[model samples]
Target: MALVVKYIVDGYHDLMDNKSDPRVNDWFLMSSPFYTLGICLGYVYIVKVLGPKFMESRKPFELKTLLIFYNLFQVIFSSWLFYESCVAGWLTHYSYRCQPVDYSRTPLAMRMVRGCWWYYISKFTEFLDTFFFVLRKKYDHVSTLHVIHHGVMPMSVWFGVKFTPGGHSTFFGFLNTFVHIIMYSYYLLAALGPRYQRYLWWKKYLTAIQMVQFILVMVHAFQLLFIDCNYPKAFVWWIGMHAVMFYFLFSNFYKETYNRNQARKEAKAAAAKAAALNGKPQNGVHQNGVEKNGSQKIGICFTSQTALYEHSSNTNGVKSVTNGYTSEETKTLRNRAFVPNGN
Candidate 1:
């Protein structure tokens, strides 16, 4: 752990000293292997081939404990990012962009470098987000949106560090970290259970906030694109994909989860009302029997033939209508005619 920390510290120092990036040298290190292993593990877990019984044992999700730790981690992580963005923004505004970048230049600037690395690390930490879902057996929540969001973020951030490392990305790093501060904080509380369930008013709005983040990211990235700056276009491509995918998936989710759902409910209600007025079963409904054991109701129950005749000239008669069997067939089938008890 000490050696690893020293290596990270050295990586930053090398970047500051204008030496070659240590990441290139460390590509085959033990930590690199672990990262690959973690990604493989994530793939297996997401695919549900990792074993269910093990995951099930972790269910009945203890929200309180989960959120407590989750928020605690958020506080520290977001705080650092908030500070990093502020410091980077400060230096870039003043004189850091065009200078040779001396080590003694600015206290805040060094902090920003550290923050850049911190932001890179935070992306991988977010893998825990999916781990929690898997453990909770909320596999349905793991959609294309979730997997793509989780997988690509860390990689993009790492590319951020390897390429541009600072500038407008700080704004994004800052805003996203800020959002995460609120988001993970909410998740933490939500995990605490029903006591906090009533407090989850902004659940839908979280996606809106994410969309806002992408807009902000697009705006900031275009800043470097317009002016002379060091941020990578490759990283921009990655970020662009993230934004586009988020928009598509989230919009679809909103449409399906809310709009289309309400439309379906309304259509069903209208059909039911029409059926009631016609004195017949609805298009897919039946009044005679309820759905039982996943089976649709037949609604073919027979009543006493004479009692049910629309205008009974003779109670003993049988007549089949265009829509259905006659009252007498119903009575005969039900054995509801002839016997005193049946009648």
Candidate 2:
């Protein structure tokens, strides 16, 4: 294992040592529209075609022993990366000061020799994000935002390691590592059970942390872009695009999550009022089971059909985001049960 890591470390050092500006790499990746297009299209194919097939093969969302083991492995993987990053940072503080450190002659001079390989390897491991989602069969949750974020982050890190392996490299990985601490832990609990759902109320805030990470990445790149930080410009811009896209995508996410959702609920209320003359269109299932009041999955009458979605995990499951209803409102709707005698 140490020998494998040494070769990988040597590989990283040979490439990143000469890098003068991070933005050069950044532009190369961003300039090629195909890079972004290919990943997106690939995920699209996965979602539209492969996604259904994958879901069909597995049971939807059961916390079996395999998932338990996966979660445990995730903890180990993320924790190792986090520790390795700290070790790399400590070495980088000395190696890049005033003069660059030469690693060809001496092996120890390489920043946490094996740590860099761990860093690179962890990038590919992140692809498991989507695979697990597919395994768990949370199809509706697998939106474009989910796919792109999962797919791009790992590749971005791969390029970052390929171009610049140490020094300010620690900066990007550290923030991400810290976030992963919370993120992976959340996933661990989420995999275990819905009892952990309340703890996940701040899932949106995780995106907020991602936004902060990108902003900091931009700042790191800007320093290298202007002043005498010896990262690569091509590399800086290459990774910087990730930051910018993350900001725009996540900002839009926040609005869609918090702001746009409210506007939609208001619009829904107004439309509901206009249609209320026929009957107060309280959001609920009608007698015929077609969602007369609200277009929900379950019906007004709790027949055998309602049992499919009533457990709250099926088609008639929680519709909190789309129609822009809050958790509170969703709860109210679920409890009311849409009887014709009631509003």
Candidate 3:
């Protein structure tokens, strides 16, 4: 046990002393990995455990105003990061194919180092994405993928800032920052209220954009394998593998969320059409074999399978359903059921 402990300590010292970027060695949360790790672990504990327990007895907080500002702030912050990344390397001098880290004290190199450090800090700020969900008691939105993605980012970026602050690998951060600008803009609009929901139809495309980003990162990182580059191979594998992992994860989410929703819509349409052809009511047979009347029960049986429908009667003696929900409540329920939980 003592030997193992000593070996681990020695390795830690070696990496910190000899392998890390000297320019960023004294920065906040950069001197050691434990600081970042502790914050991430605390985030997991709160979101998965303490946070839920705390909200169990309380009514969910309606942070409408707060959310608007938070999302707007994120949009602005992300835009700045993307611009800095571009000016530091991607736009000015960094080669897309095989750019290596500039460890010198030159102005451009220092600017990249500063950009990488701010990017690391930005990951911690994103913990609020999950925190807001927990506070609002949107537990279903806090999925395993969401938690893992948020929990791992800071620690992953810490290494980037610690070792290779700039280079081909920073391309991932560059792309990611750009994606956030779009993503947070969506969230900001959503927080404004139901009136803005009509403008938010392209939510599914956000996931597609994220998936594309991972693919781009993978291509940029893996190309180094075929060509000779001065960059470290370890970082190449690390960044490339992370991109591959996240790409598949986002792909699965897209299929489950959007594709499944589309399939349900098609099935519902076919069922409605078949019922219309047979001149029978659209509702399914009751337990005692009675036919349901009116659109009140229409789509109830089909949409109930997905638990996405709500039935309500209007003052007029007529009944109607719209897009798997009542016409009166579609706006509210759509946002609740369909909005991506910052994944």
**Best candidate, TM-score:** 3
Per-residue lDDT over 55-74 for candidate 3, one digit per residue giving the tens place of the 0 to 100 score: 99999999999999999999
Put down candidate 1 lDDT per residue, 191-293, tens digits, no spaces.
7778788899878778778778877666655444455654455555666566666667777777777788779999989988887877665554545432233
lDDT (0 to 1) per candidate: 0.61, 0.60, 0.86
- Write down the TM-score of every candidate: 0.63, 0.61, 0.82
Tell me the lDDT of candidate 3: 0.86
What is residue 98's positional error in candidate 2, in angstroms?
10
Q: Give the range where candidate 2 is weakest over 10 consecutive residues by summed lDDT.
A: 96-105
Off by over 4 Å in 1: 1-48, 51-64, 90-105, 223-232, 268-343
Residue 107 C-alpha lDDT in model 3: 92
| Model 2 global lDDT (CA atoms, 0 to 1) | 0.60
Best by the lDDT measure? 3
Superior by lDDT: candidate 1 or candidate 2: 1
Candidate 2 wrong stretches, greater than 4 Å: 1-48, 54-64, 90-113, 262-281, 284-343
